[model samples]
Target: MTGPLLQTHALRAHYGDFQALFGVDIALSQGETVAIIGANGAGKTTLLRSIAGVLRNEPGAVRFDGADIGALAADAVVKLGLTMVPEGRRLFPSLSVEENLLIGAQGRKAPGYWTLKTVYALFPILAEKRRVPGTSLSGGQQQMVAIGRALMSNPRVLLCDELSLGLAPVVIRDIYAALPQIRDSGASVIVVEQDIGQAMKVADRVYCLMEGRVTLSGPPADLSRDAIHDAYFGTAA
Candidate 1:
């Protein structure tokens, strides 16, 4: 196996004294897609936030590309080639479709496989709506813009939080259809999702979380439906 591109060791996080993450340790290697699956309030988002530097952890708690980034600020993390497609497809409503994508490349430096033209190629619908306001597009289109915006950053590791929420199955498929291309662009990914089947489809490995702790983790084919159900709901059927 390749060396880890990102890692956490005894990582803990909190929202003003209420602990949300309980010493979670996970790793992602270069060019691998790992999924963090769980129900609501399982601290999956917290884990992502911690890694992205939105929620602070002790120095050396989180490491990326052989260096410690736990104490770095969010923008600093982005500058170091780590970016997140946050939940809810948070785009700048006032910005045009093209403008939203450009913002993602603001702090980027390294020459990468993702650029405005390349991103447009990945989501051709966005190319057609290039001049439209980001919010003016439909929900599925907005989600496409969100993912594309993240791609513009040319990150070494992409952290996605709930990419399938609040979308039709067809729209979800449309969004996931881009994952293969995303992997080809030379960025590993960590997807935090509630959609088990969808996660299984795209992830090389899966980590099941419940109440801020890792319950089950392995290759998707190695995990049985019964085991996943138990890990997700905390009960066996």
Candidate 2:
């Protein structure tokens, strides 16, 4: 209660023998939105996966709400009110849109601000297509389902990976437009985004990564465009 709602300390991750992250440290204060920005292969996704418990780390690597959660399994992490909307909608091909959203509530059903009704309201198109398979929706609509599904857990911390990937600007705008409402619901957010301008617009703080290590971090206003560019590409621009 005294410190950040969630944090990673000296976090590192690997895939088989290949290391993807190196001593990554970040934090999310309650009700804040933090953006993790980096180019391809900068270990942005790896950092999120490590924190979400998909790639287990040392016991003290990830702490959430004052508990060590790095070693816990993904489901266990979710039960404690931490969730991730992974890259790619990854919806259940066999399940209806409503059913896929309901799946998120399976691990943590205590309920807070999010539920089937609220999720549908957040993405009304989902309501219209509630009985249809989740995969049947358009790319943008499917992203809404992914976000809504994660919201159903009523998580204290929501980690979003690449919400703007492969979508048109208008659709991306609509999706990013939902972040403020999500923050108003009392959930801290961390978005891994490739759109630098969008990240600056939505984030309270931004962290740039290069070669698996944090190169820059600060509030958007406090960081200059040139500094961000240098940090993002490791070259002056």
Candidate 3:
């Protein structure tokens, strides 16, 4: 793939008459992990929603595999190998862990890699509680289920929203530890995060958003803390 696997060109989003994103542009290349960081309500989640096809926009705005998919619906986007682990772990309380995983693959357009066995291997705890209701697991364990559910689709690009929302430091660590394995499994990732340190650690490239636009974007190693601080808050660190 000479070009990016996914690209957003001047993407904008609105809710009723209130706009949340302002001509945002971003990209994800094959097998790379890119992190989007910002404060609360910085349009980070909105960006993910737009790319994942939860929020519709112009067809030219979102290009996946060099094709316009911005006009597609959420389910349609997933069929094209783009899946999102939404901000909240909206697991079905009635479904067992394994059942939840199976639901994700129910609408599979084409299979590439992931399966029940592989998902269990990534989060061993899930295997032990495969028969348990999804809601009965620990926070980290539940998070694993959410991720595993998305992976079951065998997406070409995975979008993770607010991965470490409200968990203990150790739990957050455990969940993030699975990122490399996810990427290595042949799926590129775009993660929206609040923990700057954790995001910087896992991502090859980072984008700092403010209000509704990207303020700064570059490799994590190439950006200074102060620079990121400025982009994140629109002022001095």
Candidate 4:
């Protein structure tokens, strides 16, 4: 309660024999938005997965709201008020948009600001297509459903991985525009993004990852363009 709402301390991750992270540390405070930006294979997704409990790590590696959650399963993590909107917008092809959103509540319906109505209000298009199959919607629409689904659980911390991936610029703006409302709903957010400018705009603090380590981190205004460029690519441009 006194420190960060979510934190990863010396967090490392592996896929079979390949190591993806090396003692990575990041923190997010209540009602704040932190962005993780990096190029491909920089372990941005790996770091989100590690914190979301999709990839297990040593105990004490990830602490959330004063409890150690590194070893918890993905479902267990959701139950504890932490949820993730994954990169690909993994929605059920057979389920309707509303049904997909309902699935989030099935896991752990923590009483709070997010509900189907609130989610629909945030992304008005979702209300119109509530009866359609989730995958039948456009890429941007599907992403909305994915985010709505996560919010349905009313999480205290939301981990978003690649929210702008594969979408047009306008669609990307629409999606990013909703983040402030999400944060206003009383949830701290950690966004993993490749769009440096977008990340800089939304985040209270930005962390640049390169080669699986944090190369630079600070408030966006406090970080120079040259510093970010060097940190993102591991060399000065």
Candidate 5:
């Protein structure tokens, strides 16, 4: 790869003594979408956290846009154009819809595409509920806000942790529908998902992790069903 927008070279993360990621290496090109799929405790969230600078790694381990950001704090990483939409739709209950979205732009430096008006355009329902508290919206709506908030940063790389976590299938479909537009904004995306079908739908490539390590990875169409099953569950069908 010629200077990937984001690259993790033998990245590892730990919470005190409990290690989460084990020499996980991944890369994302500009405007590409990669999905990371695995069962619970596969370290998907840890990878995202590491990349977004929520968790520290060894120096020179995580390079974003050719800069070493492994030691940067989460806020500093966001300023460098990397952001994550956490697994749960963690929106502020006291903040209104628009307020929550604006908060995402707080540390923004590089200008790409997303903005308050563009976010509203992406999710019209948000415009209608601009005055409502973020938590007052329906589950599906809250998820939309989370995605929109991440976009508000105008990131070069967007890390989405479980975009379809608890929503209905129809809502999931609606959320996935916006992915193409997101990619069109010139931002690479990393989606961590348990729903294989949904992940394959939006991803150009997929990586399967097991017990804190990557066990399988390839283009979605090239990965066999059996391989995916094994990687997801750590067993053959």
Candidate 6:
């Protein structure tokens, strides 16, 4: 619970022979929210995938709770209290919203506070639509299910990829509004966002990645828009 809850040291990844990530170092403290912002192909998702155990690496690459998890499988990672709300709101088309949420708790190795009731309370509309198929909900509602499902696992660290991708402005606001509650539920968050502004609004600290390497990192307040812009695009101009 102290020091870094999750960390990566000289982490690298490959899709077959093409390495998408160079040596990367990152850290997340307990209860902190950090944002990963970069353009398309800047290796943002690759980084998340690597940490979530979706991509395997050499030992000592990915660490959680001070233990290396680089070679662990995805389910093993989840059991260790790290879960991801993947991009595209990948809800089960056959599962009802409630069913989807329930599955997140299956095989959880550690005790956690999140449950179906609190998830419904956080997103009240979900309580009303619990019986509906998760995929039938609107994009925003589906995203809610995806998030609720992840929370049901009661992860200590939550990795969210593109939470606002295709949602409307108001819907996006509604989702971001729930972040404090998510934090209160005892999970450090790493939100991967294409929109730096949204990331800045929600993150305690920000890291900008470009071409597989970290370009800039600091408190959102300390890193100016101009600085972020330069790091994001690889030039001050």
Best by lDDT: 4
lDDT scores of the candidates, listed in order: 0.92, 0.93, 0.92, 0.95, 0.91, 0.92
Per-residue accuracy of model 1 over 1-237 as CA lDDT, tens digit each: 347999999899989979888888899999999999999999999999999999988988999989999999999999998899999989998999999999998867767899989998999999999999999999999989989988888998999999989989999999999999999999999999999999999999999989988889999999999999999999844
**Model 1, residue 114: displacement in angstroms?**
0.9
> On residues 142-234, what C-alpha lDDT tens digit does candidate 6 reach at each position?
999999989998999999999999999999999999999999988999999998889999999999999999999999999987889899998
TM-score of each: 0.97, 0.98, 0.97, 0.98, 0.97, 0.97
Error of 1 at 148 (Å): 0.9
lDDT of 2 by residue, 1-237 (tens): 799989999999999999999999999999999999999999999999999899999979999989899999999988998899999979999999999999988968766999988887788889999999989899999999999999999998999999999999999999998998899899999999999999999999999999999999999999999999999999954
| Tens digit of per-residue lDDT, candidate 3, span 1-237 | 579999999999999999999999999999899999999999999999999899999869999998999999999999999999988889999999999999889756576679999999989999999999999998878888999999999999999998788889999998999988898889999999999999999999999999999999999999999999999989954
- What shift in Å separates residue 36 of candidate 1 from its native position after superposition? 0.5
Q: Candidate 2: deviation at residue 167, Å?
A: 0.5
**Candidate 3: lDDT of 217?**
98
Cα misplacement distance, residue 38 of candidate 5 (Å): 0.4
Residue 153 in candidate 5 has what lDDT? 90
Worst 10 contiguous positions by lDDT, candidate 2 = 102-111
lDDT of 2 at 151: 96
Which of candidates 1 and 2 is the stronger one according to lDDT? 2
After superposition on all CA atoms, how large is the RMSD of candidate 5?
A: 1.4
Query: Which ranges in model 3 have alpha carbons more than 4 Å from their true place?
Result: none
Two-way lDDT contest, 2 vs 5, winner: 2
TM-score for candidate 5 = 0.97
